[model samples]
Target: MSITLSIIYLISTITFVIGLKLLGHPETAKKGNSIAAFGMGLAIIGTIFLNNLEVPIFIYILIIVAILIGSVIGWLIAIKVEMTKMPELVSLFNGFGGASAALIGIVEYGNNQADITQVTTIIAAIIIGSITFSGSMIAWAKLNGSLKKDIRLPKYNLINNLLLIALIVFGFFIVNGSINGEIIIYILLLFSLIYGILFVIPIGGADMPVVISLLNSLTGIAAAITGILYDNMVMMVGGILVGSAGLILTFAMCKAMNRSLSNVIFGAFGGDSVAAKKGSTIGGHIKKTNPSDVAVLMNYADKVVIVPGYGLAVAQAQHVIHELEELLTKKGVEVSYAIHPVAGRMPGHMNVLLAESNVSYDKLIEMDDINPQFKNTDVVLVVGANDVVNPAAHNDPSSPIYGMPILEVEDARSIIINKRSMNPGYAGIQNELFFNQKTSMLFGDAKETLTKLVQELKNM
Candidate 1:
């Protein structure tokens, strides 16, 4: 029975590896998710029935019922959630993962405290999992607009550093048997949660992708710690995979934005800096154009690039924009989407949004690949994107996003930006691109404006 269970665990671990590899591309991501889920299901079955732990029938029934309820709720949420809310949904799910790991540590601590190794693992799990849970919840709130403003306490970085040191010292004392009280663990958990909230609440929404990824990595590390306590091979492997992948992605996102991990955590960027920018104004003449004029420009263009952003998702205009793409394609004009690494609220957000509307995968060119093409392009239609394409990234050293890499849309022959208004982007600074001689703004909801543009294109 032990051999059979080991074989099952091995197979499950293999599936996890395979699934994760398959997840690298958008085309196979769904398949990879299903494969990983199947592996997890296999692992659970092996643990429940194959393991010789004679559990009570009622406990088994309770587990099954809990699984059913959770699965139903998850399914409902996934189906009903709009594309615009996907980032918060992901943040919420990451929090649940952390909470689950922390719960396991709490429930198993007493049972495993006799062993020094188990005690260390449990303590580690509790700290990391607690922090991940609370931090991810705060991230979810910020992403979903439930927390509209960043709340920065006085000397927040100093406070956070002190709290972190305290957590480490407490954990070290507990591991060394200096703090033997059962209540001590609970104290650590409480402080860890507080630290998590403080860690995230000061960060502005612009930096949420990195935060989400970091929290996800923490959850994975916590899961691995719990797996060590339980001697679960499948769990350990899965956790490691998740932890490493999320960590790598976090660094990639930081690099894409031309920021460092330490800066992201301690800089508390896009909060106070952006708030100050809100009171300031950019001096320039705003050139405005209507759908007909923009449509005519696009119709006569040799090549056009479309840039999608958070506003495009909010307006639910992916389909309309896809229609516009198709219309231009039929008119002998080449159309492609220029996707910035951190374009939307989360990683790969723009790609997913366009994919939902059945946009060709090949047409969604990434930032580096498309930037040089902008010079040769006739028209660049920015659909509700602001920060990623803002010229401030290049010329304005005083701007918050000054050092970040941008879309370089200014290089195009003509730039037409669609937006509801001249409001600033997530960075809370005006886009200098809007005032450039070759750029014109089309003001309205993206969906309404795109629909009008498509109609105008058809007339042309």
Candidate 2:
């Protein structure tokens, strides 16, 4: 890179780092996103100008049209998508990132003169980007519940590991100039995709936040490898930032759940779908309470803490939930939100929903910040939340979720859960929190139930 280009890369790289740093807290996340995006735009412009392209005018026209189309489609999706479906949207976006990186490597390799080092970079980019892309798509499928979360077959673990090794070996052959290896390349891609699907298959819904974080890291690795191959300083730095941040967050989540990456990757835990079926009846075991009754309890309580989960997002009840919180606060009751590390479909699903709804950022407390406080809370409001509150994590030795950490909401003075029915949660486990002595179930739509509670609280 020239001196001038080096300066540009440095400025863009700085912006990305600062943006990521600002994003560590919710209050600055929006600004962080905008800043990061600006940096990326600058990097792209810098590259286009510096690449010294001698392409035809029609090629330029084609590129412009593609960008416009992509921008328009992305905007439409952003505008219309419900918050409940954000996880799938995120997965889709992540998959695109990985796919784009891998394709860039392929095209670069195809258009270039070959040597050992260049070929190594090409191979690295292809292998890493393919894994990232496929892994991300599989995560999308799992979050969308399109694929069942289970082992899917006996000894699948061994088979998947062996296949991953085979893919690695095949990649080496492609890099070493194997004769007409294009067919082998395509086949390897197929195997990579299948490996990703099988890898995340045995991981239940409870592990999705970790899965998302891990995939984000993989995407970053792919981008970094591509950057190195292309000798792009900005790309390399930006990719490193993303990779490091993602990995740190992933590690934190693993620790929060008292789990290791290997345990989660190998699906040693989080399989609870059959727990409800084999266990005692949820209704017969737990107290069933109405919304109005729960409303009265909330109105009477001195403090209430709302715990949200994937179901709350599915119901798109964050705004309605805010109204309930507002109503409680008006009644001279202290109200706060307890956000778990794996609260929703993604890592920060609850935070994003609440932030979008203009909920007070200060009201959203992290798991550690709110766990001790939950014990003192007069009424713990579980708004369509499940798995996170399960007591099995605390005491069940043989439980699939054993050794995992959970909210201590079961220790609250009283608990009110709003849900449609006693369906097992995505982890496929019966939440013992629902059956606690102080817990009461309010069966209905989260949005409507919260709305009803707000009205009832107003009357009170």
TM-score per candidate: 0.95, 0.91
> In model 2, how large is the Cα lDDT of residue 42?
80
Best by TM-score: 1
Off by over 4 Å in 1: 26-30, 273-281
Q: What residue runs in model 2 are displaced by over 4 Å at the alpha carbon?
A: 1-3, 26-28, 148-151, 178-180, 272-284
Over the stretch 32-126, how does candidate 1's per-residue lDDT look in tens digits?
Answer: 98998898889888887888877899999998899899999999999999988898998999999998988887787767667788888988998
Please list the C-alpha lDDT of all candidates, in the order they appear.
0.89, 0.79
Candidate 2 lDDT (Cα, 0 to 1): 0.79
